[model samples]
Target chain A: MMEQSKEPLLEVRDLRVDFRVPGGYATAIRGVDLTVGRGEVVGLVGESGSGKSISMMALLRLLPAAARVSGIARFDGVDLLSLSPRELSHIRGGRIGMIFQDPLTAFNPVLTIGAQIVEALQLHDRNLSGKAAWTRAVELLAEVAIPEPGRRVHQYPHEFSGGMRQRAMIAMAISNRPQLLIADEPTTALDVTVQAQILELLQRLREELNIGMIMITHDLGVVAGIADRVMVMYSGRVIERGQVDDVFYASRHPYTRGLLAALPKLDGAREALVGIAGTPPSLINRPAGCAFRPRCSHAEAVCATAEPPLLRAGQLESACYVSDRLSGMTP
Target chain B: MLRYIFRRLIAVPLLLLGVATVAFFLSQTTRGDPLSAVVPERQMNNPEIVAAAKERWGLDKTLAERYVIYVSNLARGDLGTSFTTRRPVSADLAERLPATFELVLAAMTFATVVGVGLGVLSARYQNGPIDHFSRIFALLGSSLPVFWSGLILLYLLTVQLGWFPGPGRLSAHTPPPPPITGLYTLDSLLTGNIPVFLESLHRLMLPAIVLGWSVVGVITRLVRSSLLEVLGQDYIRTARAKGALEGRVMIHHALRNALIPTLTIIGFAFAYLITGAVLTEAVFSWPGIGSYAVSAARALDYPAIIGVTLLGSLAFLLANLATDIAYGLVNPKVKLQ
Candidate 1:
């Protein structure tokens, strides 16, 4: 059933991603559904093996050839999967931009930053002259607060430090004023200070440009700072979804609770941090029913026998049968 | 750059010394003799003529004495006299060197332009019909024996097709250009003789093509693989995500990164052009060093053999040196290290 309300800017429904292995097929992402309104920042939080990156890559149809993805990913009411490669390519950078995690490996070291940025502009607008294109590039670099934009424009990616490279990457991503920006763990590799600065820049750009974004991360702190709404994923499926405050303060899913409990407190308290037990299930041979039932403290016979659907739990929606376990309503 | 050249200059003489030592011993110990090839069997049977020949050529001295004289001559830029022509060996190589240089230069120019262009097109439309066609053509060039290909081209063009002449540098009827730099093309161009220049260029074209075709396959594969590797890097994806045209990504973002490895392949290929294409030159009778070296080895002309061997070794050394310098230029990591 569809929601009888204002249409969202991007809507993904019942998405399934499976891969062919040597023995048989293995499903990595199983029926994940989420949406983002225009100008909203949606955080996709999960541990390393939770398929957060794959789901984001799936939206762009950018996964490997072996990946078999099915379901609807509608962007501006256009089915992204249904478009031809040519149309998809035109949309890939012009409409929906992506910023990868590693800044060091994210740029071609030999080319000048100006040439790289100008090329991005020229791809869509063939009528622009080289001088105009270069001027636009310098302007974009300046927007990103890069010092001496004109002088730094001619410098190669290797000439800049890590933080500068990240900024240059940001300049390239937002140059075309894309509608949707996906930043996948963009600050995980940088130091704490640089990470905070990049997050701040991203939040500022999101507001100024009024663009929708899907920020993928395993850290709850990142989600806490910038996310308007949050989707907690476990083994490629959406386990919880709601407003960021409701999801963070009133988390119903055990995985979400575990992720929150695992976070180290910033306050100067000497309490021991509780770590999540059990390794993530391997994609090659996953368990039946609820994937996280074995690790859930409140799991029962019903939890292991039948997979729970994404149903209502207080203010948030979660895919856990024992959602009321912590509330003492069920035993 | 200075340090790189210094390292290369030091390495060159050591490489030459190793090559000279090998060439000298190999020439001495090989099946045939310079005496038999030059003196004739009848003249060699006469002891007085043989002794006189040995003394005059310094063959009567100990091996150590000959080596000392050999190194001293090398130091003085003297390559010694030829056993067959009874002329200074340097003069013979010098006469042939320009022709070889001219031919190699033409071949390299043709190969780089055609091969790299084809590679870019193929990679851009990868696995498409054009890519398939290009890959097949490149494979044919790569797998075909160069000597056989040369003969086939000769037969098809000269005998069957009747589109071109066979087995010569230029037309026999025309007067040879005034030896300005010993390269016919340059001399004719310098003298402003269009007809002579055209004639020389036309003849050079086929030999160059035959040699260059093999190089085309090598460089195309090199560029294709290198481009493919570079294309998969995060920077290329970032470039694409930034709305850079696919063409721009291929050329500006991908190709520069690709050139690093491709350059090393090209340098070695050029060095190989000198020694390995002997059959192609022999088939076409292009009068390059390849053909001359083959005969020099057969006749056991010690000086000619030594000179050609040393030059070939020097070519390899210089090629490697050039590759290192190019590597430093292309890769920031290399320069930093």
Candidate 2:
């Protein structure tokens, strides 16, 4: 058997997403550059308030009614922003699948899992008959390792256990077998064991299906386990980008360091885990200069003077003005 | 489901008892007495005649005793004699109910077909010109007085245009069909008299339309709003995502759930059709309960007034109860709750 070569399946470049606030417009995603090659997993890590989810939503043009997206979100050389509602609808579930965060709240409560999955299949492939659609739906459910797939397929979303519902969501997402799968906090609401199993299932599926993925999560541990590359976002801007190991072991950005330090090590080296102090800046009225400058301990006058742009730091991109200083090199 | 029925069954008798008690006292308390209408012109000022009338009708007894007698008579389907008509109240209701029912059925058919169709179409094409127009139409339909509308229709369609008959259930020249049932439409149909049936339809059409216009308006708005809300739900999005066609998603997924609220409105509208729109009945002089009740009031026929009022109230309550059961059946979530 010949080895398949890796190539970019999805690319988002210089993307900006803005929303009109009370008296002014607030940028939800500012000049984010990201890529997910075929058979690769890239995690988008940020806190609750960060625009990681917004960026993903923008890539799919799935933002709320108020959002205004610009720049390029290219999946297979086709710009998403330029597509009409009809064209976009074609790609949404047909080509690029999305799994929402909360499984319990994701699926329509009234519809049976089989019905939802079959609807997705029938939507894209009109040639597939009803019997064929149901058969394929059952196959997809079984592929997701749903025990008693035949019986469970007839059950509504609420009938299933939480983990089972999440699996059903995955089944629905992948029923069409799209080129790229966007899993947004797919296991955030589950127990630890279920989370591990789901992540494992996702990771295994990525390899087996060779479909690209953009996994968005707040936990760095999730990125470490599944992501080949990781991007760190803060206040609607990408702060750091690199290979997972480069970003994790040798983080050169101050915010990245603060985030890494905050992670509770599984080895229990510390009796109590430390957390990053101070709250995330509000998008409605952001402060001048670097958004993170107020929270940085090594802040100098220059740090607060102007907003630092995301620039290349060795092999990775770092937005800090003092990336060298954070890396222990004098400017 | 059985639990709901059991609850309603227990409530019916209690409600009927309350209605009976209120009717007995309200009649007693009212200024004019039933004997005032029953006594002949020659005996207008005779106390002996008034006392005889009261005793014959059993109205001279204490209120509680009158209620017991009323309840017992109602159990045996005896609604007492109509004080003004000198006919049995039950006979009057039996003669009149079928006519009203026919008119009501016609109105309901018109309302359901037009209102629900317009509503679904409006919601399906929300904010479009059709939706806007339907909304405006519903507003106008709801706001117009039924009696005024009926009068205008009579003038335009019957009096001037000569497109329909102005009033009554049949043409005077037609030998009144053998009166099997008082409802001319049914009797005409049973004897296979096409012209008579068609003529009866023509006479009833304007009144039904006038009465049903508000119902159509209400049902349309109810269906449109309910469908719109259902269309915007996440499951609808999920259905769309599943690649279900827009029509399928709407009809199969959104519409059925939306009908829960709509069914309630439908029940209320049906009840209104049965009891509301008194003005339209009077305008056309169709001899339905609306007109009957009015004449009964003017002539101080207490028994007839009480019977009509109780019947109307019963229809309203039963319609709502049926709506609840329907709502439960349509959505299992509602049933569980």
Best by DockQ: 1
Considering only chain B, what TM-score does candidate 1 achieve? Answer: 0.92
Question: What's the DockQ for every one of the candidates?
Answer: 0.51, 0.33
lDDT of 2 by residue, A32-99 (tens): 88888887889899999799888887877666567888988878768988987778778878888888
Chain A TM-score, candidate 1?
A: 0.95
lDDT of 2 by residue, B43-153 (tens): 967888878877887868888897788888987877777888889887887777777877887888888788878988999887899999988888878998887778888
Query: After superposition on all CA atoms, what RMSD does each candidate show versus the true structure?
Result: 3.5, 3.8
Report backbone clashes per prediction. Answer: 0, 3
Name the runs in model 2 displaced over 4 angstroms: A1-7, A21-24, A269-273, A328-331, B1-7, B105-135, B153-165, B168-205, B216-232, B243-253
Clashing pairs in 2: A119-B242, A120-B242, A123-B243
N/CA/C clash count, model 2: 3
User: Local distance difference test, per candidate?
Assistant: 0.84, 0.82
